[model samples]
Target: MATTPAGRHIRNPQGTGGRLRADILAAAGRILESTGSDDAVTLRAIAREAGITAPAIYAHFADRDAIRRTVIEQTFTQLATVLTTAADTEHEPVARLHVVCHAYLDFAARRPHHYRLLFERHRAARGADAGPAAPDVGSIVGADAFGVLLQAADSCIRSGASTAVDPVASATRVWVGLHGQATLQASLPWFPWPPADRLATDVVRRMADLR
Candidate 1:
């Protein structure tokens, strides 16, 4: 066992390589959460947080971009699971849609740093040079999360609970509103805002055209 620069004892223990990978990712996540900036998630910082040498990180991740991508993927997975569970709690189409909206808001509120990484920072990273063909947030987060939101919106339309003609368009509108709301709430927590549940419900109803 060797002591890392952070004065923490570290041990690879031969077959724990998989575990080390997970630890590296976890440490990176903590750094992102604390700093809320990708620029702060340097290899040295992650290694220090993980109690491992910077070279060891190279064994698991090719570079900082790989680590960041993995972290974003994990965050999206968590959000999708939460939204799916929230939607399952209510059987009615309209109610399920509202619940999913609340879950989305809850995720943003609970993990502001992760939310920033996923949306704000991600957009900045994609850059204007990425061109029109670059993948957007929905694609980047993948089908799991965005699919849940779209499915919920489609459910409302299929059940006649929503007056929207195009589920895709309606879902896009709902996503836009939810993102805006979450961003505003996180940036202006001191502002006088409506209750979270009430605000989320209103956004869903209006955006999804839910009856």
Candidate 2:
């Protein structure tokens, strides 16, 4: 729709085409978030949203999966960043974990489709990454978030936080608990839960209460 606006796509990243690529990727991200990395993320759709055409998407992405992968990868990294920052804020072992729970839920509620496209919707369901989703090459938040949970559980172990004392299991349970609340909120919004953030905070509190 908008004219190439002078040297648009032809310009390299930072050299000339800065605006075009940015616009395409952002549109792709929104499409992924809103549409669950479905068929709509096609070059044509992205281009259409960008007021361009299929050729424009090709210029930006290798193929549909590449774009989907990029969007998914970036989304997880962002989710991890939110959790890590929350974990960093508090001093108490339990409270630190609670911060992570709230942060994670906050991210989900605020970006429900992005959250769903990332974790809740199975890749098979969407027909993306057919074999399985690729593992993170060099993770940003997912691995870091797990590390924080492990560290907290380790503290729980050292401080006699619970009788059921397997650090990995404990950490996993916490993950499951928090994710359970989030998943319910995401997948079945009609089932009646508190606000997403509240449900998540409650789960986190309950997890820390383990004895």
Candidate 3:
């Protein structure tokens, strides 16, 4: 087996390091989505999906948790992009807020497994210490999806479109409400849900006190 300049075993001497890493992450994502549980996202399963041996995963990820962390970060980064795009198109603060809310719901609906992995399963795994100050948010690192919502709420409050005095508090309330709606919709698709647009708009308006 050929080794890199640093003397580490090159799992696939024919494959570039970056490509192999991406393949491993993608494989792990598939397993997480299919199983809808973190427990199933094992190194062996990812290796099988990636057509590599289990030890090869270690070349890119230190352990299962590292892969899990990367997957969550990537998911949140994508979500942040979606939310940012949704807010950018609308000039009006209230309209932007509504668009962002709908975008979040849409993302959750489209990526139910990813959504569950990030919000549901991950939270449960944190046990009783997963409070507001939990490290999960900090662990996400670069992406700040919640910050996008906060900025919109802050703009609305400043523009008099919303009566909320505290942007952070208002945004947190809106986020909590949106999370509940999204999780419920994803978890209970068979249950009757009001039109998504209407429900999302109503929640945003009521929570943000949007005019």
Candidate 4:
């Protein structure tokens, strides 16, 4: 914990002050997670969790929705980085895609809260968009997240590996299909029994026509 000038101990061990910001984001995530990651988050509750004046949030985020966007964007960026790397070495389209899918499922399973906050939330509170000046982190990292799959899928199309290899369709297919499995696995793991890897591999093989 870092000591503030006022002799109060801060929970931020990283010393980046992002710890405070992260705490606020985390608290907001908690509210959204417990209630639903929608418009339920309030500045007062988040401020209480972060142990600071609510208005102080204005210094960092323009409003509550701004923090939501930041939190979701950061979550996607982190997912993109992880899933992108998970399939780094595999050159085969289907194999590479499977690894990426597994990486995504693993991430969602481990951080269901972040996953839900990023994709499931309807909107946020105290909300105002960060605006034109702010980076569109959604498209940015989303592109990265699926970049490997696109590259490999395109290669398969060029090589006549899959006649269905239209880039947009293929990319969208993999994304939707992968997200379905990941979402199910993360949110409702008890519905039935099948190994995630096996089921995911079967899905990818069928979709990509992998041998």
Give Cα-based local distance difference scores for all models: 0.83, 0.66, 0.81, 0.69
Task: List where candidate 4 sits over 4 angstroms from the true fold.
Answer: 1-23, 26-40, 122-141
Question: For residues 18-129, could you state the per-residue lDDT of candidate 3 as single tens digits?
Answer: 9889878888887877887778888888877777788888878888888877787788889999999999999898888888889988998888888877864454334345
Candidates in order, TM-scores: namely 0.87, 0.72, 0.84, 0.74
Model 3 error, position 196 (Å): 1.4
Model 1 clashing residue pairs (backbone): none
TM-score of 3: 0.84
lDDT of 4 by residue, 76-100 (tens): 7788788778778677766676777
The best candidate by TM-score is: 1
Please give, for residues 1-211, the per-residue lDDT of candidate 1 as tens digits: 3457997767656446888899889888988888878789999998888777889888888888888878887888899999999989998888888888889988998999988888655643444466655455455544588888888898999999999988779988999999999999888989999997888888888999987
Off by over 4 Å in 1: 1-10, 121-131, 134-139
Cα displacement (Å) at residue 74, model 2: 0.7
| Model 2 spans > 4 angstroms off | 1-19, 33-37, 120-141, 192-202, 205-209
Global Cα RMSD, each model: 3.7, 5.3, 6.1, 5.4
- Whole-structure CA lDDT of model 3: 0.81
Specify the poorest-scoring 10-residue window by lDDT in model 4. Answer: 125-134
The order of the candidates by TM-score, greatest first, is 1, 3, 4, 2
lDDT of 2 by residue, 1-211 (tens): 2436683433223323557767777778767667765567778778777666566666666777776666666777787787778877986766666677677777877887777666543353335434454454223225556677767766766676555467767777778887777777667867866666566666655665545
